[model samples]
Target: MGPDDPDRPVKLAHAALHRAGEPLAFGGGVLLAPGTVLTCAHVVNQVLDRPDFAQERPGALDLLAVSFPATGRRRLRAALAAWLPARRADGSPAAEGDVEWSGDLALLRLLDDPGPAALPVGTGPCHAGRPAYAWFGSGAPSSIAAVLVQGVTERWIVLDSTGSAQPVVGGYSGSPLWDRAQRRVVGLVVSRSGLRAFAVPAADLRELFEEAGEAVPGPLGVEDGAHGPMDPVARQLLGPLRSVLTTPEALADLAGRFLAELEAEPEPGPEPATGPGDDRAGVDVGANDARADDAAAIDAGAIDAGADGSGADAGFPASAERLVRLATARPHGAPTLLALLAGAARTQEQQSWIATTALRVCPEQFLTAAEHRELLTLLADGTVPDPRRCAAEALPLGPDLEQAHWPEAVAELERYRPRYGRFPQLLRTVEFAAAAAGPGTARGLGAWSEAVAKRLGLAEILLEHRAQARESAERARERGPQRGAPAPVVQVQLWRATGTEHFSYALHAADARGRPLHRSVRDTPVPRSRLLAELGALLEEVTGQVEPGAVPVVEWFVTGEELDLAVDQWVYRPDELFPGVLGQDFLCVMRSPELRRAAFRPEHRYRWQVLRSGRLALVDRQDPVVQQRGAPVPVCGVALCCPAEEVPRLRAIALAVGVPGVLWLRPADHAIPPDRVRELVHGAAPYQLPRLVYEARLTESPDGLHRNLALVWDSPDGHPETLGLGDPRD
Candidate 1:
């Protein structure tokens, strides 16, 4: 899934069989609906007295339970609701010695919600080469970094383990193999042979649902295309990214043109401006009056002028002809064309077409080093909304050669917002794009296998780093501290008995100084159930020792063989955390005690602060309806209507204060209640943050833009005056 995949929340933790002291993981199940699960029937079948026959009859319900990771490892009882037995075509159950059996799928309904959201039943095809994600229940549930479907039969889809780190082991049976491209669970991994795994195709799953008289829901767009699988050459050249390209031949031709141009001479005239909208006025005004020949020539000029204008004399018609043929044959040259277009589009029209075309494709590889830097630059400075949005979307999904960090990505995105402020479809894409760094970290961790060695030496590295930081701070203090000593900063460390697992907190007495003393250590093992109680105790202990004005700062660290092994360092203010108050407004806004508790964990908070904080707070996301593609999702912007005389104060707040999604709404009347202003400012949805602050200016503004946070005066009529700010027509 590109991002915001609904299926992500519903991956069921596989069922386990508890023996003496060890829990034997036997099968996996996927959440099909609220309180309902889909798995393999054989997984939950109990062997009869003869040992040859396995059935769901008698005491089988008591033996099966479903586990949910989101529910703090809670195991809930489940009962078989439906099943298609593993049997021969003759309808006889498979004999004792018969190993290969068809129709192995089963569905179970949970006694209660297992705390995981349900996964919608998919209607898409399980195609070969599509990216798949399989979570297995071995010891603890672990997700495979990469799983690719190798083949698709009528009833089953075959999975190739070459890309994944873990094989489809025993416990993986009944696990859903999710196709990333289609954004659905296409199959259930039912059996495996060495590195190969097989899953019941989505068609069978849909058929099963239908036979049981259940409607497999929509939002699953189309079933797999009827075209037979692409041959090896096609797979090698374009892979799955070909699905997005509208004119693949054109892309290949573009790439070929680049190659041909490289071999030709450069007739460099005054460099043509190739950025978005550079030719907008020229192209849009009276172009209809121009002959068809002139229009074609202009189109030709777009390609030949060549992004920076150096390749203005290169072959154009021949290149265009070649592009069509190549796209028809195979998108083998897609990557080359993408790389070329990243920097070489010569005209506004060309750039727009390329950008729009790119939005449909999701490349598997990262951008080239030059392309990566250029994309970042475009995001930071590109003016036209479409091209800028394309660059924003491209950055995250594309590879990061520099191993670019999320903070840098976030900053660039923030800069891009105002210039091209409103693309709701792109917002979700950007949110996922920003998170590429975190997954990149996880990918890096997979390659490193010296877990024990790294574990042994990590403490020393951490302490040494901390010591050096303190020394740097002490030196800074001697030179002249930026501010006076901050309120008492206490470092609290939480640990488990393993001497290996631990969590630490550096509670700052004050947040205003933006500094912490980093002295002392305390330890505790935080299971979420008792987390609030423990934090309460820890807070009391630290509060008594710290200065009165000190603001507590806490950070968590998990090491050794923890579930999430990544050494993530995320900080949270004590009051801002769950069961506390960051500010009165925040407390009031996020009022649910249960919601606060669920969201208070280190992993969740770290993810939000690092990955998901665009305009929309995805925290309490409800089930989304079918998203209207390309539509601008609304984000409420603050519209302050005030008397013209008091405009200066409003202007000051708008210009001096920078908050992510806020805009000054200028009403023609320029008059509204003060309380209403506050409500508008705080209550608008995330989408309405002003990209460009517009104001009726007094002095010629500093930045060359006409927009400003204006000081508007009230009309004498005591009616709301109209400003073009909220006008539907820009």
Candidate 2:
């Protein structure tokens, strides 16, 4: 699976469609021979925004930008050399609906050196039971499906999936069908029917392939819901803002103010309230002929997509009209802007138009522009804000929501990106970080939330006081505690990797001594599907149990090779989610019983004692193919990554030496340089590795540092478990 393995030409061969010079992909394609690519013609039409059977072919100058996702982002220009529009056997084009097409093939030839080699060049009948592989076209074949050619037609082949992790969705067209039994590709995957894949046979490819080239694929590198349909609430808030900023000046002012507040140096002092009506409010709402004809006349920095540092200078006038044109013109402008400006405002406006607008709009959450700017800078600059102290700790909450809101906000801000722009949820988190960042950092943010709470009669203001009072009273009541009596509350925990890795887990909703605490379990074995369904259903119950302002932490009890199983990467409630992962919300930790018991050993004792602060050693495995016991002496928790065959033994050696924490990649092929991961982890502590790896996995690239990263984190549970612990049941 390494990049040097010429037999597996994954990266430099698989290609995706993009506008010339852009890195974004529109659809998938594969290299046939040097300089040539084959894909479904519909993908080209889709990218070009043309009708499926548009008779016009691409001109010679109309080259498409292509990139091999598995490989580096080395873009190549490709021209359409051959085209066969979606047509019926009669050679007539298919209808404009979502019907299948038998002849929707296309070939694109690179202008320069095609780096990848041609694929297998033969065509024939396929066996019905033989297993094959296919993938989504946008990126590398990280998640592939095993397909079987169930039925064949003169031009179409019906391929059914045996089983696969990812579904064969809309983006999977034009991928290669690698028939495993024949050890060569038999056809091209042209379309899918639910989980079932429909392919075009190789006979047509040989006749159409001509002399060509190769390439490879990887991640689409697109975030989930990056193209949001806009939530009902978001759209509601957006409506008012759109209506007000009709003229070019108002839009320009808002956009300019947004940019200015984003980079403004905070001034120390109180926020003086301004009047509702300004003398300049009556300034012409209509666009005068004084406006510049060309858009380049405006400051480039204000609208730069790269999030550059340069900015607009003073004397640049504002305009809602010009702003509307820019927003209407650009497709990628997030906030998913839809320009609709209003006519003259007969009645004058409010104190601090931005602040007044923030209060009136976004009734769901009082997220403001100032708060967003402060937070965006913090996230962009990579500052992890800590919970504040004092009354400001109590916004003017540093305004005091760090304790109230920062935790949730900090959680959201992890590995923040500027492209998120002004998402409501994103703003909340940014304000959360600001509140906890100390002093007057979060004054404006706190003021906004409080204003909203007061307006809505919300009791959120007294939440912190109530929690603190409860804690003090409890401590006062239990003055002479000797391991205070446990509450009747249930101790719910989900145990993963206790059995076979995939789709298996053990549940414990009991008290300290393994006695039942939560709801009663169905003692009898019902249907297997029902049992798994119950496990999924219980997630809601577990989520409900979490205290307000607190997160749900899923502690996994795993041991032996089970430690290497990737459980964090699992998708939770995917059907309803915006493609969220289990680890994103849950503070997942793998706790091993073996490591807990090993505390009797001095080396184990030493390891945990020092690793309490998350520090650890990264043990490099010198052995190329075999397991070695050459771990460093007296080290605390350590990373001992090795080849897959050597992993089990290396894990055993660490466990034997009493190491309480460990990390490694599993089923890992060195397609990405193994040594490169060290650079990502250079200054990170052992405790930070899990989050680091989780973020890396989100890249969805085969060449990502998170190649099924697994960890053995047997940290202390903040309670004494060592007093007397032993296995009771077999």
Candidate 3:
């Protein structure tokens, strides 16, 4: 075979030696230096052992012959060569006494030169999954089969052969698997399964050979005809058949037939290459056409090499070596410099550098919309480290773009976003945008809408408000409440009553005569003293009822001495006293003629119950069970009363019912204005009650208790009222 046969296969074999009576043993080797041989330390040891040293048979321990099919049936003796055991890849002895089995390799030095046709050494590393061939055989017509290295091991290799060929049999050892393209021996087929086999990498074998003072041969091309053996059947069929078919007339006929076939085949219509520009002048049309005709079509990919071939394209802004040098510069400015350079261009080099720098600096800048989109495309198409790094670096840049840009960014982010929603930055960015721009602006509202989006997720709140406003305006136009429309008047009845429905008073006011004022009802039960004191103080001011000698007194009912007494107080009617009342006030009076006429029932109990099983019961003071009625009543709602011993339990009950606060009513010495009372009871709750009471406390009084009443109110609104019930002079 010539030195370039397309079908030529390489062989990787092992050499073994059997001591006289001992069983046969073999060690791994490769045909690196052509006719020369390279084997493991154990192989060399077997070759050196003598028959007398280990047993009984004669000639069994004789020097074995090494041969290749290309050299015919001639066998070479092992004794003619030197053997070195402990040598480094540089052909020097390794560190003294460092005969470690991990580097279990040895080299053979042939006494005579093996001439040319030697197997060459390979440089660089091999990538995973690249197709490879292996061989295992000896002499002419030796057993040879094609195999691929499956895995590399510390001592042995795992391999796989296409056909059912045994990787290891008798007499097939220490053969090299030559890489046809590089004309170098890349691996040594050592172990074999029924069809699968493994070869030790040639790079590793070469190091072992060089370490033992042996010269590595130049690569033997595939046409070197160095394959070991073939099946007799295949040989006869292929050999004679091939020779008979090679006649000039036959060749001409075959060529003509092939040409006719090519002509007969349908041709592909030309396709317009869609791109920004036409840069196909330098492209090899023949190669492209061939590729187009092949089963796989040609695809334009990201260009790494420059138009002018200088070196293998680094596909980066700077050479990786240069970048490394810069990264290791004395001033340590490479990261910043690289970042600046990345911003200047959008080349592969710049992208690479930016990605690299981002790993150390701010990754967010490089992971921009354009770069991220581009990187995603590259990654999807199976680009390596660069794509991997691009993806990794893109992670830190939060999804903070506008709503329109979010879909694309999120699509890119989806590749790496955590399944459990742990990406806080992504969530935050989406949320912030939604909150600032409103939910309408936030597109793609889904379960994964950012936390901010969820927070502002009130659907079309503003739109609904606007629609309502429009509807209101339309209604106003249709049914206008004007001055001429029946004077637009309303009559409201205001009522007052003494303790728990003993007597009652009522006044009716019309909008026209009484000047209808807007009102809000807030149910707040206050101490009766508080009401009396407040009303008395107000009467004192409005009526000028100041007396010189008599002690000022303010009663629930102002009659006789109550009118003469100068009680500097203010009184507030129930409706005027509280705002935001959720229920009607329970009123009782004994003196009012209206109450007497109505036959007011003092036995009737009025109370309010909350949804959560809490109750507030009202009882008249004049009733027989006044104290007991006011005792711890199993109430079903929030209660507001003066600050008392029972308040803590009520507060607890209110809290249990989720009523935010309670109003605690207390007796008052002086009247508090209706406005101030409303302010106190409007949203009164327990905790806020003390604060209100403190503010209302008389600061001038050293002994705090004598000042007045301190009312504690607890409600969601937290309003509280306090009135002074002590002697104003003291």
Candidate 4:
């Protein structure tokens, strides 16, 4: 085929060959049956030229190496079966003297089937001008299309070479010229001359098979094809379903059609009253007359099997009853078609009908786990009738029921178990509930066996929830968070160093802004509590830092190594020691220099706080002092310059500092001259920043101090939430 035409069907039937001792004897074949192959007779001649074929006759050969031409991954072997040597109609070898070859064919019977796709030989005529596809399994097999020119003889056909872009080459000798419209192989390629090629007609191949006394496979895509006419019993039962499936449609579209069919059919009469202690009054009549009435009811469709297949006197219409019956009967394609219909149902009505029908047919065989889950969902939602009975009967007992809203299912099972008695379904449901309930609950299954023993009257059921409740009560004596006066918010800088054997850390305690309170670096690993004790002692020296009990906020920075240290012995070991110290009151945040430097922009705001003997000092935005010539630029708006690793940090800092419009600088910005910043800040119309800060100027794109700048202040909401993140490096 052409590059775009899908050839998977043809390739599945193609096979290739490799024989011993003949270097130029590469050939191809088509799978004619489960273990049967058809190829050119000349290919067999080339094999006979080798020494390996000298002693072996048909049905006596050891093995012949073969493979799939399309995907030659594994080599397989087939045994020589029979050969129809290239010959004239006069019974002389056609390859000898001046005689021309007519029929050239060879058949092989594989010892082990390689599961190749089988293409039946067509019995119908392959006429001229019809499109034909030739398939081969070469090193690079081609399944290109060609047209049939003419039938040269009964045993040979000529291929139209002008339109056949792909001609018969070395490995194309045994390829089948498949009739695309016919869906069958009509001939096998034998040779090519000038612009034309020749193929052995499938009729002659069939004759050869008959002469060899092998059973001929039937024709394809015809009335006489292999899967024959539908059974009369199945047709009678599935007539309506078959009519719905007669039209070609996708699986998903079948739901609408099936629903339409259901709607068009008449609804069932009202169900007979069924209630506790009333069975004797309505349906039973009298015990002596039961058998005759039941037989009549069955004939009239008054009673049908329930979803559990118990024949439990459930009411259903004649039409629905037959639909379920045929579905269970495997009527023609009913089982497969109904499965597709059930899978495609999207609405509650559709799912309910399909699921209920499948359950009624044979739940154990038909219902999949997902279908069961859907049924359980309906049960939990209080949507279906007699859900408890459905759950106990239709639902499989396992962790499969332990899905969302499982608590409702558990409650249903628990409430109904006693009434269900010793039924296997009910017992299975109880076992499922017990195993599914997770640990540390009063519903612990320690008393399950005891309860069973008590039910059997062998022992008393012991209560197990009391000990668990008492243990929970005793655990209330543990310590709680200290309820003292507020402490000053402390700014802490902790440096962490990783070495060959242990972690060396330095702690720097300070007041909120940058006043140093204490500094110490531990030379050896010490308990975090001991270090906290030493820090508390330093807190007593606290000249200008503390209140009574104000909560402390710590911001820590760690550099040196990344999170991946599985290769090393000395790691952070946070799971053992640091995790406990770092919870709740004591919090540590790690920072990198790249992130900190990127966050340090001049135009943004930074608020400072000071604590002096429990008194507070707070400072708001302070403009940067001019450090350059030619009228130092004022902090008119915010600008963000950060590396890729610090985007989130810069985002938080920009909001924290109350910056105006932001100008994000890339890593490439550092390589640019310092003079470039002047151009970026003041090169454009100088008053643009002032106009944006005060008058709220609008432009096509955001107009800022530089063409490349991002205008955060111009955001439609004028909030940090709308300041969309952008990568400036690109």
lDDT (tens digit, per residue) of candidate 4 on 188-294: 78776656678876535665656645554432212221123322222222322322333223311442343333222223333345564442213332435433333
Clashes of 3: 84
Best by TM-score: 1
lDDT of each residue in 1-730, candidate 3, tens digit only: 5546542433222233333343443443444444545654434444556221222122322455444445333344554343334333333434433322233344444444443443423322221233444333432223445555454444345556565344455334445554444434555544344565555554354444455455545432122111222212111122111222333233233323322322323235244353533233122334444323221111122122324433232221112222222222212222233333334434553343233223322212213223334333432322122211222122222222222234455444433332112222333333323222323333332233422222222323333322332343343345442211111111111122333411121111112112322222212334545534433333334223222221111112222112111122222343454521101111111111111111111111211111111233221122222212222333322333423444444433333333322333333355332233334445543223333443444233332222332221222210111111222222
TM-scores vs. true structure, each candidate: 0.29, 0.28, 0.26, 0.29
Q: Name the lDDT of candidate 2.
A: 0.46
Model 3 misplaced stretches (Cα beyond 4 Å):
2-4, 7-31, 34-36, 49-65, 75-101, 116-131, 139-142, 153-157, 179-183, 192-196, 206-730
Best-to-worst ranking by TM-score: 1, 4, 2, 3
Instruction: Kindly indicate the candidate among 3 and 4 with the higher TM-score.
Output: 4
- Candidate 4 residue-wise lDDT at 72: 46
Whole-model lDDT values for every prediction: 0.38, 0.46, 0.32, 0.40
Which regions in candidate 1 have their CA more than 4 angstroms from the true location?
Answer: 1-7, 10-22, 46-60, 96-99, 116-123, 138-146, 209-242, 245-730
Relative to the unseen true structure, what is the Cα RMSD of model 2? 26.0
Please give me the total number of clashing residue pairs in predicted model 1: 38
Give the 10-residue window scoring lowest on summed lDDT in candidate 3.
581-590
Which tens-of-lDDT digit does each residue in 1-730 have in candidate 1?
3236444543433343221233555666766555566777677663112232354433456655566543345567776666666765445677666545667766676786655343344333454545777776542445553577766543467777876777777767776676665555666787777787788865456555566454444311122211223322222223222332324344445444644433322232232344564422122223332222222322334334334443321333222333322332322233334445535545453443343333222232122223333334433422212322233233222221221343344334423321121222222333223222234432332222122112212323333323332343344346453322222222222334444333332222222222332233323434433443444455555556543433333322222122122111111234445434211111001001111122122222222221112233211111121111111332112243454344434433321222122223233333433343344345333322221121122124344112223211110111111211121222
Using alpha carbons, what is the TM-score of model 3? 0.26
lDDT for model 1 comes to 0.38
